[model samples]
Every structure is written in structure tokens, then in C-alpha cells.
Target: MTKFRPCIDLHAGQVKQIVGGTLDSSTDALKTNHVSLEPAGHFARLYRDHDLRAGTLSCWGPRTTRPPLRRWPPGQGACRSGAGSTTGTPGFTSYLFPEGKFSQERLDAVLHSLDGDKQKLVIDLSCRRRGEDRWFVAMNKWQTITDMEVNQETIKQLEPYCSEFLIHAADNEGLQKGIDETLVQRLAEWCSIPVTYAGGGRHLEDLDLVAKLSGGKVDLTIGSALDCFGGSGVKFDDCVAWNNKS
Candidate 1:
């Protein structure tokens, strides 16, 4: 069944919902949709109260000023932090250092470190459409495009090394124009493991749309569209209700 997975994005020590493509090295290039005054712990507790599992607490930019994740209240559900991996292999060992430059040696190191424990890893295959009907993975805060194509071949090869895949449509992310149905459908067809698709979700019906399009195989994550995140398109309570349906 399709579920509403929640998210809390921290950028430069503040909770924010930013347009994916607009994020880059230059601060002026960033386009932010919402900035929450409440701390991350607030949303963490809220999701716990609702029993929302698998929610992500992602750090969008430099974490120099960001508070340590430990300080946040527990019960935020299982979190996958993707920030501060620039120096060496992250403690999590899932995210790639240098943010999306493809290196077979680095990949092998990560895979070897896992020692066949795939469940501890989740690959972020977020991408952008290019050429004609092709999607290439975007990296470096979505400013660079890698040569890897997000297709069945890639998914099949990586499936055994990772437990789940988190894909965001970089071009449509944070636009609230509706999800890339083509991308969602392709993900459902390609992935055997659990996949969560985020970006361009505008309404509650999108949840149903994803369920129908993916046959309830792929879960949806609505960031800028949820009311709690300063969006008016969908109510947080309604999503909870949808999840609670018998």
C-alpha cells in the first residue's frame, strides 16, 4: 500500500523546503519555498505522535551551524542523515562522499564495507531528465549530472547492495506541479525493494494517483505540499487519516 512518508529538511541550521534545482554552491542561487520557525525536534515528535515511520531528516547544506542529530528528540523514526560526508566514509556508509561523482572504486569500498549487510544502506538516485526521454542522476546538491542512467539495469545491479532507494525528480522538485508520473511509473517497474518518490506532489489525490500508478508498490513523500510545511495543497491530518484507513 502507498503511504505518506514525511520529511524535515534542514538547510544551514534551519528547517526549510527548497526547490531542488535551485540549490547549488552559491547561496544566491537557492530558491526556498518554506522556512519553519519550529526546530527539527518539533516535527520529529509530531511524526512520532502520528506513528509515521521511515521519515527522513535530511541536511541540505553545510552543517557547520547545524545542531547535532543527537540533540533532536528520539522517536523521529529511523533517520537517514546525508550531510557531512566530505572528509571520509560516513559512519552510516550509505551516502557517497563528494556528493554524486561516480567512482567505481569508491562504490566498491562502500559495498565491501557493508560486508553483504545491504539493509543498512539506502541509495539516493535522485535525477533529472535530459536528451530525449532519459533520466540521469544529479549530484553535488543537484548541480551536476552524472553519467549513470536511472534505469532497470542500474536498479537491478544496485538492488542487492542497498535495501531501499530514495529518488527525487530534480527538475520538478519543490514546484508543486504534481509528480512526474512517468518517473514514478518507471521506478515501480524497475525497483524490487521499497522505493520512496519525492518531488512535485501538490494534493492529497496525488497519494491516490501514486498508488494507482504504481499499484501501491511505491510510497510517496510530500514535502512542500503538506500544510505543516507551509504548503496549502494538503492537510497533514488528512494524510494521517488516509494512512489510518482500514
Candidate 2:
């Protein structure tokens, strides 16, 4: 059964939902859909109360807003924090780094930082379809198209250094169009470790679809489409219920 995972995407230290592709180095290029006045801890507590674990807390841009959002809240359900390549804040069980430039130095730095503790690490991978309908990893907050293709070879290579994988379909993220079906199936077939797939989830139905497509191997996260995020496509309560039932 595919479980419904929740998320808190923090940009500039505030809780907000933005188009994944719009995240870039420049501020003006950003396209935001919802900005929550409540701090990131509020959502963290919500997830905790709902027992929504294995969710993602992603930092969108520069660390202008300071700590606490990307810094996972203590005592909350198990959540992964992805803020910087080398920094793992308090309460985060793992460091979910963005491999933006595909540099050996960057990979080595993360590996060295782990110091033989690969279980406390994760790689946040977002990919877009390009030539011949293949998924190639996008880096730099899903703005840069890297040469890294997310295939068995890549998964095999990264598996030695991380406990699991978190993938976002950058092209459909926050659009609420639909979950990336191909990516879900591919991830289910390829990943040996527990992998979570997020993007284009418009309703509770996508959860069932993901379950069927991935053979219940992939977990999901909804953002802009959720009722809590100023969208009416999916109800947060319904997702909670779905998780409980499944």
C-alpha cells in the first residue's frame, strides 16, 4: 500500500509552497503559491500529530530566515531535512543533500562528513524528462539539468552511502496536475532502499494510483494540491485517513 506522506517546504525560513522549477539563485524568478504565517514547527507538529513520518522538510533557497524550519523539530515523527550539502541541523535523523553539480569533491565531502555513518544520510534527487523520455537528475533546486541520469547504475553507486532516496519530479511539482507515473514505476522497479516520490499529486486518488503503479513500493507527498495549502484538490484529513487505513 502506498502511504501518504506530508511535507513542509521552507523558503527563507518561512513555510511556503512554491513551484519546484521556479526555485533558483535569483529571487524574482521564484513563483510562490502559498506562504504560511505559522512557523515551520507548526506544520512539523501537525505531521507529528497525524503520525505522518518519513516526510520531507525541504529548504528552498538561501539560509536568510535562519534555523528551525530546515532544522527538524525535536520529538516530531521521523522527518528528513534537506537544506545544504554538508549541514544537518538538530532533530534531523539524516542529512538530505542536493547533489547539484555532480562533483566528486561534493560527493566525497558528504561521504567524509558521514564518516562511515551512511545510514544517517539521504540524497534529494529531482529529475526531469529530456531526450527519449528518460529521467535525468536535476540539481540546484530542480533548476539545473545535470548529466546525471537516474538509472540502476546511479542508484547502485549512491546506495553504498545512503540509507534511502527522496525523489521529486521537478516538472510537475506543485502543479497538482498528476503524479509522474513513469517515474513512480521506474523508482519502484529500480530502488532497493526505501524511496519516496513527490510531485503532481492532485487528490487522494493519486495515492491509490501510486500504490498500484509502484506495487506499493513508493511513498508520496502532496503540497500545493492539499487543502491545507490554499488548494482544494486534496484534503489533508482524507490523506491522513488514507494513511491510517492503508
Candidate 3:
């Protein structure tokens, strides 16, 4: 079924909704949509209260600013998110995983590590559109575009390595304009495993659009537009109700 998945995107220990394209190293270039004063636990409790499952808690900050995971002190919170930098480095593609010598071995080593637990890995295929209809996968905090194109073939090839795919349309994320409908349709067609699509969800009706377009196969994540996230488009309670009905 097409469900509404919740997300908590933490930046510098605070929950925030940020523009996906401006996620470079430059603070001046970074555009923020919403910053919540509530800690990660607040959202965690809320999701639990509403019986929301498969929710994502993403830490989108540098290592130094990341929140500690220790729960020793009662008030302290724990959050672990992936971070990277592409500033001042030319040809950052050199840092691409399994690209250099013994690339196959490196890839095999990773696959071997998860041999019995491949389901624990979830691949994020966040991407940006190139020409009119082409979408290429972006890496390194989405600052660099790789040669890989986001299509059925790529989805099939990588399916064996991960249990699920989380795709965010780089251009539409945090804009509250609308979701990339074409990309959602293609994802529905290509992906056999569970896939969650995030970016540019404005109203509650988007859930219906995704349900129709993907035939209730792809789940949608609304970040910036949710009422709890400081947007007026979709109320958080409504989302819970939608999930209950779904």
C-alpha cells in the first residue's frame, strides 16, 4: 500500500528541513526550510504514539556537530547520521567507493560483510535530473553526480546488495512545490523491493497522487510541508489517519 512514512532530518543536533540542492559546504549557500526546537526524542515519541513504523531518523550534520548516541544522562539524545564534504576538492569522484584498484575486491568485501544480513543495508538513490527525462544518481551529500543513471537496470543490479531504496528528488526536496511524478512512476515500475520517495510534498492529496501513480506500491515521505515541521499544507494528525486507513 502507498503509505506516508515519517522522517526526522537532524542538522547540528536539531531537526530541520533543508533544500536538497544547496547541501554543499558553503553555509551561505545552504537554504533551510524549517528548524524545529524539539529534540529527536520528541518526534520519536510522537511516531510511537501514532504507531508509525519504518520512520527514518537522518542526521545531516558534520561529525563534530552530531548529537551523541549515549543515553546515560536522561535528557541526552542519540542520533547517528551520514555526513560528507565536497568543498575545495577537485574531481571528488576519486573518492567514489570501489572505484580504484581492486574495486571488485572492495565491493566483494562489503557484500561479504553483509552476506548473512544484507537486509540491514538500505541504499539511498537520491538523484538529480539531467536532460528532460534523465535522472542520475548523486553522491557525497548529493554534491557529486556519478555516471550511474537511475533506471530499472540500475535498480535491478543494486537490488541484491540492499533490502530497500530511499530516493529523494534533489531538485524537488524541501521546495514544497510537488513530487517528481515521473520519477515516482519509474521507481514503481522498476523497484520490486520496498521504496520510499521523498521531496516536494505539499498537501495531503499527494498521498493520493502517489497511490494512483505508483498503484499503491511506492510510499511517500513529506518533510517540509508537514504541519509539525512548521508548514501549513498537511497536518501531522491527518497523516497518521491516512496511515491508519491505509
Candidate 4:
């Protein structure tokens, strides 16, 4: 069935849950749902102790501050997060994989980072609707328009690089309305690797619906609605119970 994966969204070195679409240049417009007083490493250790795999580490920082991530210990953490800048971070370059070629040195660093066993890599296909039921992956903090479409072909091309796919329906993300059911269904049919869906999950039942719709091939992440974050629609303990049962 659909398991509840964990997530730690970092903004300015703090764990935060903000409206997905509002993440643009202006920090003043952010609709923050919750900002944890706990440090990012705390959540990392918590998830590690719980054996929560497929947890995401989305770094919304302007610069790559990896000391906190290192404190989490990559050995003990089950996270697939990215740190990027519009221009690019120095050591951990923000540019896309081989596609967004900077220098050979930078490209090598990016590729080498994803090295190891197949399960080490997970590609994030954060996207928005293009037109007429069509969707395209968004880049550069979901601001730049990309021609890359979220079709079987796109997944197939990315399959060689990663063990799983993490997709956020950027439009519906953090809205707590409902999931893009069509997108979940489509991803289940398209992806060969494990996939996780995040965005617009307001209630606990949405997890069941996603499990049913994707035939248990997809997992869910609830942010604004979870009690741990701030809102109170879905209790964090219940999500743990659901995963345990599954």
C-alpha cells in the first residue's frame, strides 16, 4: 500500500513548510505553514531512527550549506535532496546534470556525487501543467520553463541515472487541496523505478486514495496538513501507523 515517507524542507537553515508555488525570488511573499525550532539534523536523526526511507532533503537555500547535512550523516540518512542556485553553487553546482553543462570540472562533480549503488540516486521531476493535460518538468526552483515533458520517454531517459523518481506537482504542492490523481496514475504507469508523490495532501484519506489509484506503487508526503508541521488534519503518529501496517 501507500507508505508515508518523511521529508525535511530547509529554508535559511531551518526546517520549513511553505506554499510550493510561492517559492520565487521574493521571500516576503512566502506563505509559510510551519517553521521548526528544531535544527535540520534533528529531523534527519529522527527519520533515521524510524527507518524512514525515501525521505527527501530539499535545500531551498540560496547557497549550499552542507555542514548541517553532514551532521545528519549520509550513512544513517535515507534522503535524496538537491542544493542549487539560479546561477550555481560552487562545490555542489546548481546546474542540471550533464544537460546543463558548465565546465567539465563541474559536470564531473555532479556526476560523481550520484555515484555508488543504483539506489543512491533519485531524480526530482518537479513540474507544472503545460496545456491540455500535458505536464512539463520545471527547473531553477520551478521558475524557468523547460521543454522537457513528463512522459514515458522522459522517465526512461532519466532511469539510467537514478533508482527512483520524486515528483512534486508544483501547482498543487503545499495547497492542501487534493493530489493530482491523474498525475499519480500516469506516473505509476510510466515509471519503472520507485516513485514518491508530494503536494496538496490535506487529509489522511488522500494517502489511501493515492495507494488505490497507483496500485500501491506510489508513496505520499504530507506537509502543511501534518500536525508535526503546524496544521492538524493528519496526525504524524497515524501516518507512522499506516506505514507500519503496510
Model 2, 32-73: lDDT tens digits are: 888888887778778877878877777666763434543335
Q: What's the lDDT of the predicted structure labeled candidate 4?
A: 0.73
Q: What is the C-alpha lDDT of each candidate?
A: 0.77, 0.75, 0.73, 0.73
Error of 3 at 45 (Å): 1.5
Kindly list the per-residue Cα lDDT of model 4 for residues 1-246, writing each as its tens digit.
Answer: 678988888787778887888878777877788999888788777777677766777777465354345544556646656434322221121255334322435434445665534455556777788877788877665766566788898788767656777888889878888999999999999987888888899898988999999999999988889887887889888888788888
TM-score of 2: 0.87
Q: Model 3 segments beyond 4 Å from truth?
A: 64-108
Give the runs in model 2 whose Cα sits over 4 Å from its true position: 63-66, 69-77, 83-101
Query: In lDDT terms, which candidate is top?
Result: 1
Residue-level lDDT tens digits of model 3 in 1-246: 999988878776678899999877787888998889898778877776676766555655564243443332342222212223121211111233333211334434444655635555556667899998889877666777777788998889778766677787989989999999999999999999988898999999999999999999999999999989999999999999999898
- Arrange candidates, best lDDT first: 1, 2, 4, 3
Q: What's the TM-score of every candidate structure?
A: 0.88, 0.87, 0.84, 0.85
Stretches of candidate 4 off by over 4 Å are: 67-77, 83-94, 97-109
Model 2: lDDT of residue 126: 74
What would you estimate as the lDDT of candidate 2? 0.75
Candidate 4, 204: how far from true, in Å? 1.1
Clashing pairs in 1: none
Q: Kindly report which residue pairs in candidate 2 clash with one another.
A: none
